[model samples]
Structures are given as C-alpha cells and as structure tokens.
Target: MKFIDEAIIQVVAGKGGDGAASFRREKFIPKGGPSGGDGGHGGSIYAIADRNINTLVDYRFARLHRAKKGENGRGSDCYGKGADDIVLRMPVGTVITNAATGEAVADLERHEQKVLLAKGGAGGLGNLHFKSSTNRAPRQFTFGEPGEELELKLELKVLADVGLLGMPNAGKSTLIRAVSAARPKVADYPFTTMHPNLGMVRVDQNRSFVMADIPGLIEGAAEGAGLGHRFLKHLTRTRLLLHIVDMAPLDENIDPVREAKAIVKELGKYDESLYQKPRWLVLNKVDLLPENEREKICKKFIRSLGWKGKSFTISALSGEGCKALTYAIMEHLEQESGIGNEEQIT
Candidate 1:
C-alpha cells in the first residue's frame, strides 16, 4: 500500500425530511379537524479509526462524501422517512482539522475511535402542532432545514517507541535492520528510504518495542531544504530519539562533528519540542577504524562535539554492540513507563 499521510475531503450531511399536513373529511360531519404528523430527523456523518488501515490513499482519490437526502412528507398524517448516516474509516493516529478555520477537530490515537464530523439539520413542525382551541382547522406547516457542510484536513502520524535520525547514508537504516526485521532499501546514495519504516525490536521473549526510521535531514531543513520537515512529523510520537553519527566518512573532507551539529540545529529550528526530546548519540561505522584506536576515536569525537548525553559505539554492518544497544533502549523505555525489569509488560 502507498504511504499517504495527508488528505483533504468534503463532507455533507443529509437534509431533514419535510412535515406532513392533512385534514379529515367525513361524510356525516360538516367540518373536518386537522391531523398532521412531524417530520423525521436527518442523517449525520461520523469518522472512525481502524487499525487495518495504515494509509490515507483511499481518501486522496475519493475527496467528496455526501449522504442521501431524506424523503419528503405526505398527507394523511404520514411522516417522511429519514436518511441513513455515513461513516468514514480512517487510519489510527490520524488528526482531523477544519481546513477553513485551522481548528483541530479530533485526534484518533486508539483503534475503533469515533468522532462526529457533520451534524444534520433538525426536522420541521407540522400543522397539527399549531392547532389550538381558537384555531381548530390549522393549515400552517414548516419546511425542512438544510444539513451542514464542511471541508476537513486529515494528517497521520506513525506511532513508535523510538525514532532514528541522522544525515543520509549515516547508517540509520542499517542500524534498524541490524536490530529489527524491517528491511528498507540500503544503498550508498542519499534518500534511499523515501518514507518511514517501522520495526519491532524484541529484546527478549516478553520485552519488545517498536522503532521507526524516517528519511535523513540536512542543514536548512526548516527553510525547505532536502526533503524539508515533511518526514519530521513522524518522530513527534516517539518517546526517544537516536541521533546516529558517521564515525568514519568515505570523504576525508566531511567533518562528522560539524555535520552532527548541523543536524541538531535543523531539528531545533523545525520544532523546539522535538529538539528537546530525550535524544542519545549512536556513533556508527566503528568497524572502519582500527580495533585499538576505536575507543580513542569515539572519545575524541564526543569531546569535540561537546556531547554530554549517553553515547554508544556500534558497527551496524557487523552487528557489533547492537545487542547492548537494543537492551539499553528497552530498559530506558521500561523506566519511562514505570515498569521494572522483572515485570513483564505484555
């Protein structure tokens, strides 16, 4: 299935049915009394979150959703029939907003979650309601009201326990592949992974967590540079972020410290809250360096970058330090959720 995170659509509710007006005509009686009935209510529109759906491509093509109008009222105290309601199924983690006013209408985080999108108009009154002692034979009746129409914007944000970020070819995808079963495209070129890929990292039989790897980020991403912030929104739902650093670059001219700092700056510019998230450093491609100097190189790089947070040295291609990395991440996640190592979450 295609990955579509955004969509725009229009919804129209069904109109209310008209009221019925009639009078009795008897052979023996000289005058007849009023006998009318009220109209039926209109149909409404609702949206539901389904776990089976993972994309918004269906909504991308079908942009308009309209309900059937209610039946008209008739005579002889007969009320009109109401129209059926319309229900739209969307993916979980979808956020609905009013396109015209830019107001957030709903945030669907759980499966089977439902929310009202449009409201139908009320039914009109009949002549029987106006009949009184002074006016016995009433001929007054009201028409049905129109339904509500609106345009909405839907955006989907993937849910994950951890997110990976770095420059292109920085081993973000390789790290995910080494830890989990997600097999995204691995190439030497930039932007090999166009969309977000999720992986389930099982530290043990009873402990596991979901990880997401998004596209790479470059300098000036907030100013519409290099895929922009289009993929950054996916990381908003993650509890932790792993900032991968290329310990050994193919080009000797590329400064890993400067590149790492630029990526962090771009993140801060794009979103302060995301920048402030619990982020750690993962220095990858350590196999490219000598075995004896690996520790020295990593320490010097961290010192040069002035990073105070936790840092790990791992070779994603050779699976070195990957197990320890996964175990540490699982422990951190459990701590955040207020769970202990002896306690099983599942």
Candidate 2:
C-alpha cells in the first residue's frame, strides 16, 4: 500500500426526516384526534481509529464521505426508521482538522479510539405534539433540522521510539537494514531514500523499539530545499534521534564536519524542539577508514561540531558496532520509559 500521510476530504452528516401531519377518522366516531408520527433521526458520521491501517491512502482517493438520511415519517402514529451511522476506520495517530476553520477536530492516537466528525440532525415534531386543549384538531408540523457539513484535513504521523537523522547517503537505511528487518533501497548514491521507512529494532525477544529512517536532509532543508521538511516532520514523534554522519565520504569534496554542522543547522531551522531532542552522534562507515584514523577523525569532527552528547563509530555495511548501538538504544529506552515525550503508540 502506498504511504499517504496527508489527505483532504469532505464529510456530510445525514438530514432528519420531516414530521407527519395526519388525523384519524374512525368509523362511528364523530371527531378524530391528530395521530401524526415523528420522523426518525438521521445518521451521524464517526471516525474510528484502527490499528490495522497505517496509511491515509484511502482518504486520498475517496474525498467525499456522506451519511445516510433518516427515513420519512408515516401516518397512523408510525415512527420512521432511523438511519444507521456511518463509521469510518482510520489509522492510529491520525489528526483530523477542519479545513475551513483551521481548527483541530480530533487526534486519534490510540487503537479503537473514535471521534464524532459530523452530528446527525434531530427529528422534527409531529402534529400530535401541538394538539392541546385550546389547539385541538391542529395541523401543525415542523421540518427536520439540517445536518452539518465540513471539509476536513487528515494528517498521519508515524509513531516511533528512535529516528535516524543525517545527510543524504549517510547510511541511515543501511543501518536500519543491519539492525532490523526493514530493507529500504540502498545504493551508492545520494537521495536514495525518497520516503520514510520504519524498522523494528529488537535487542532481545521481549525488548525492542520502533525506529524510523526518513529521507536524508541537505543544507537549507527548512527553506524547502532538497525534500525539505516533508520528511523531517516525522521525527517530531520520536523520543531519541540518532544523528548519523558519514565519516568516510567517497566524494573527497564533502567534509564530514561541515556536512554534520549543516544537518544540525537544518534541523534547528526546521523545528527547534526537534533540534533539542535527545540526539546522539553516530559516525557511520567507519570500516571504510583505517582503524588508526577512525578515532582521530571522530574526535576532530566532534570537537569541531561542539557535540556534547554520546558518540559512536559504526560500519552499517559490516555490522560493526551495531550491537552496541542497538543495546545502548534499548537501554536508554528502558531507562526513559514513561519519561520525556513517551506517548502510547498502539
């Protein structure tokens, strides 16, 4: 299935049926009273969060959603049949907003969570309700209320424990493939990843964390440059960020220190809170360099970039230091359980 994170749709609730205006005329009876039946209630529109769904592709193609209208009332005090509600199943972590009003409608973060998108119109009163001592034999009847119509925007954010951030061809996908079952496209080129790919990194049978590797960033990413913040926004839900730097770039012109600094600047420009997330340095492709020069280059770049957090050297292709990295991430996740921005991602 295609991964669609954003979509726009129009939702319309059902309209109620009109009230009936009738009078009974029985045999051998001089006069008869009003026996109008009330209209049935209209159907409502509801959005339900489903764990089985992971994308908003369904809403992308089907832009309009309408509920069923209520049945009309009948004579002889027979009430109309109520329309069934229309329930729309959406992916968990879907955020719904009113397009015209620019207001948030609901955030379906958990599985089986539901939110009312549009309310059904109420049924009108029948002629019997207006029958009183002074208003006998009345023929008063009311029309049904109109249902609500709204244009909505839906956005889906991936729920993950760790996010990988780096420049293009920084071995983010390779690292994920080495540690998890997700196999994203890998090649000896820049911009190989076009979309975000998620992986389940398992430290053991029971200990694991969800990791997301989004499209790589470049300089001026915040200003709509080179895939821009379209992929960067996915990192907002992650608790930890692994800033991977290509220590051994095949292109000699690309300086590791400068590129790392550019990634940091772009992240800060995109979102300050994302920039402030718990970020650790992961110098990738270490095996490509001589063992003697690995430590020197890592230290020099860390010093030049003024990085104060923990750092590691790993070769995503050779699986070097991947175990330690995954172990450390799992340990950090355990220690930070229920701490920081740890939301329940069902």
Candidate 3:
C-alpha cells in the first residue's frame, strides 16, 4: 500500500429526528390528551487508533464521512430508534488537527485510542411534553437540533526507538538492513529513499528495538530544503539517534564533518529539544579505509570536533564492527531509559 502521512477530511454527525404531533381519538372519550412521542438522538462520529494501519492512504480517495440520521418519532407515545455511531480507524501515531482553526484535536499514540470528532444532535421534544393542567389540548412540537460538522487534517509520524540520521547515500539504509529484516530499496543514486522505512532491530532473543530510516536531509532541511520537514517529523519519536557519517564518500564533493554539522543545525532549527536527545556518532564504510590508516583517521576526526560523547566506526555493507555497535546502543538505551527529555520526540 502507498504510504500517505497526511490527509484532509470532512466529518459530519447525524441530525436528530423531529418530534411527532398527534392527539388520541378514543370511542368512549370525546377529547383525549396529546399522545405524541419524542424523537431519537442522532449518531456521533469517532476516530480510533489501530495498530494494523500504518498510513492514511484510505482517506486519500474518500475524504468525506457522515453518520446516520435518527429515525422520526411515532404516535401513541412511542419513541424513535437511535442511529448507530460511525467510527473511523486510523494509524496509531496519527495527529488530528482542525483545518480552519489550525488547532490540534487529538494525538493518538497507543493502540485502541479513541477520540470523538463530532457530537450527535439531541432529540426534539413531543407535543405531550408541553401539555399541562393550564394548557390542555396543546399542539406544540419542536424540531431536532443540527449535528456538528468539522474539517480535519490527519498527519502520521512513525514511532521508533532509534532513528538513523545522515545525508543521502551515507550508509543509513545499509546499516538498518544489516541489523533488521526490513528490505528497503537500495541504489547508488541520491534520494533513493522517498519515505520513511521502519525495521525491528533485535539485540538478542528477548531484547529488541524499533528503528526508522528516513529520507536523506540536506543542509537547509529545516527551511524546506531537499526532503524538508515532511520526513524530519518521523524522527521526533525516537529515543536514540545514530548520526551515520560516510567515512569514505564515493563523491569527493561530500564532506563527512560538514554533513554531520549541517544535520545537527537542521535539528536545532526544527526543534531545540531534539538537539538534546541522546545521540552517538558512527563513521560508516570503514572497509573502504586502509587498515593501518583507519585508527589514525578516527582519532583525527574525534580530535577535530573535540567530542565528548561515545563514537564508533563500522562498515554497514560488510557488517564489520556492527555487533559491537548494536550492543553499545542497547546498553546506552537501558541506562538512559527515563533520564532525558520526556516530551514527544517527533
């Protein structure tokens, strides 16, 4: 199925049924009181989160949703039947917003989460309700209330434990493929990944974490450069970020250090909190480097940046130095489970 992260839809609740206006005519009684019944309530509209869904592609073609109207009231003091509610199933990490107002309505993060999008109209009163001692033989009846209608914007963000960040063809996809079972399209050209791909990285038999590989980002990604903010939002939910740098770039035009700085700058511009997330640098494509010069280059890179955090060197294609990197990430995640910022990552 095509991955659609954003969509616009209109939702309308059902309208209430009209009240009945009737009087009883008996053979024995000359004039009887009003015997009209009240109307039933209309159906409501609800949006629910389901884990089975990962995109908003279903809403792409069908953008309008409406509930069923209530049945009309009947005579002889009999009420009308209420209409059934309409429920819309969406992805677990969907964020619903009001299109006109630009206000967030709901943020569904867990499975089975539900939110009421539109409320049903109330039922109208019958002529019998207005009948009293002073006002006998009344013929008053009220109409049903109108239901609520709204236009909403739905956006989906992938939920992952780890996120891979780097420029195009920086070995991010290769690293994920080596660790997880996800088979993403791989090519030598830039921008091979159009959308974000999710994979499950198993550290051991019982321990595992979700990883997301988003499209490559350029220098001015925060300002809508290259893939822009569309793909960057997917990284907001990650607990750990792996900054993959191509130690051996096929194109001499790319600079590993400058690329890393540019990605960090973009992150800071998009969200200040993202800059504070736990991040580790990984120099990929170590197999391309000469064995004797690998250690020297690693030390020079670290010294040039004056880095203080952890770092690793690995070749994603050949799986060299991958085992150690994965174990280290698992340990770091365990130690800082609840330490840093608890705000929503994306």
Candidate 4:
C-alpha cells in the first residue's frame, strides 16, 4: 500500500428531521386538539483510532464525508426515526486539526480512542407542544437546528520507541532489515527510502520495541532541501534516536566529521526538543576499514566532533555488533519504563 501521511477532507453532519403539524378530529366532536409529533435528531460524525491502519491513504482521494439525515415526522403523534452515526477509523497516531481555525482538535495516541468531529442537529418542536390552556388552538412550531460542518486536516506520525537517523545510503535500511523482519527497499542509489518504514525489534520472546526509519536528511534539510521536510515529524514520537554515520565515505574527499555535524545541525533546526532526545552515535560500514585501524578511526571521529555521549562501531551489512546494539536498546527502554511506572505509582 502507498504511504500517505497527510490528508484534507470535509465532514458534514446530518440535518434533523422536520416536525409534523396536524389536528385531531372526530365525527361528532366540534372542538379538537393538536396531535403533531416531534422530529428526529440527525446523525453525528466521529473518528476512532484503529491500530490496524498505518496510513491515511483511505482518505486521500475521497474527501467529502456526510452522515445520513433523520427521517421526517408523521401525523397522528408519530415521531421520526433518528439517523445512525458515522465513524471513521484512522491510524493510532493520527492528529486531527481544524483547517479553517488552524487549531488541533485531537491527537489519537492509543488504539480504539474515539473523538467527536461533528454534532448532529437537534429535533424541532411540534404544534402540539405549543398548545396550552390560554392558547388552545395555537399553531406554532420551530424548525430543526442545522448540523455542524467543518474541514479537517489529518496528519499521521508513526509511534515508535527507537528512530534511525542518517544521511542517504548510510545503511539505515540495511540495519533495520538485519535487526528485524521489516524489509524496506534497498539499493545503491540515494533516496531509496521515500517513506517511513517501521520494524519491531524483539530483544526476547516477550520484550520488544518498535523502530522507525525515515528518509535521509541532507544539509539545509530544515529549509526543505530534500525529502526530510516531509518526514521530519515522524521523529517526534521516538524516545531514542540512533544516528548512523558512514565511517568510510565512498567519496574520499567528504569529511565524515563535517557530515555528522551537518546532520546534527539539521536536527536542531527542524525541532529543538527532537534534537534534545537521547541520541547515540553508531559508526557504520566499519568492515570497509582494516581490523587494526577501526578503533583509531572511531576515536578520531569522536574526538573531532567532541561527542561526550555513548557511541558504537558496527557494520550494518555484516550484522557485526548489531546484537550488542539491540541489547543495549532493550536495557535502556526497560529502565525508562521502570522509572515511568514508579512515578505513576507515586
């Protein structure tokens, strides 16, 4: 299925049914009373978060959505039938916003979460309701209220525990394939990954975490230099980030340290909070270097970049050091979750 992260659509609630106006009459009775009935309420529109859905492609083409109108009331004191509500199932991480007002209406983070989008119109009053002792023969009725309508913007941000960041063809897709069952398109050219791909990395039989791989970022990515502008939002939901750098650049003249710094700068420019997330540098494609020079090169790069945090050297293609990387991630996540649970209890 094609990946669609954003969509714009219009939603309209059903209109209420009209009230009935009639009078009761008999063969011999000279005076009769009003016997009209009230109208039925209109149908509403609701949105639900569905875990099974990962993309917004369903609402990409077809934009307009409307609920059924209520049935009209009949004479002889017969009430109209109310219309059924319409529910739209969206992805778990979908964010709904009001297009006209530019306000966020809802953020669906959990599965089966429901939110009301549009309210149905109220039913109108009948002539019988206006009849009283003073106005016994009153002929008054109110029209049904109109339903709510609005245009909405739907944005999907993938929910994941770990996110991978790197330059194009920096072995991100390759690493995900080696660690998990997710097999994204792999090639020798740049921009191989046009959309975000998610993979579940299971540390044990019962413990696992979700990982997301977005398109690579180039310099000035925050200024819409490349595809990064389209998918930078996906990184907001990740708890940890793995910054993969090419240890041995295919182009010898390009300095790996400068490239790493450029990537970091782009992150901060795109989102400050996102850039502040816990990130570990992973020097990839180490197999291209000799065994004796691996440590020396890694240390040199780290020192030049003044990186104080944790770092790892691995070959994403050969699966060397991949197990250690994944195990470390599992431990970090476990500790974080444990702390969260304790805070909740307190």
Candidate 4 error regions (>4 Å): 28-30, 339-346
Error of 3 at 42 (Å): 1.5
lDDT over C-alpha atoms for residue 23 of model 2 = 89
Whole-model lDDT values for every prediction? 0.89, 0.89, 0.88, 0.91
CA deviation > 4 Å runs, candidate 2:
338-346
Error of 2 at 43 (Å): 1.4
Q: Which candidate is the best by lDDT?
A: 4
Instruction: Give one digit per residue, the lDDT tens place, for model 2 in 30-140.
Output: 578888888888889999999899889999999999888777777788877778898999988788999999899999989999899999888877898899999999899
lDDT of 4 by residue, 232-265 (tens): 8999999999999989778889888998999999
Candidate closest to the true structure, highest TM-score: 4
Cα deviation at 177, candidate 2, in Å, is 0.7
Q: Give RMSD (Å) of candidate 2 vs. truth.
A: 3.3
Estimate TM-scores for all models.
0.94, 0.95, 0.94, 0.96
**In candidate 4, residue 40 scores what lDDT?**
88
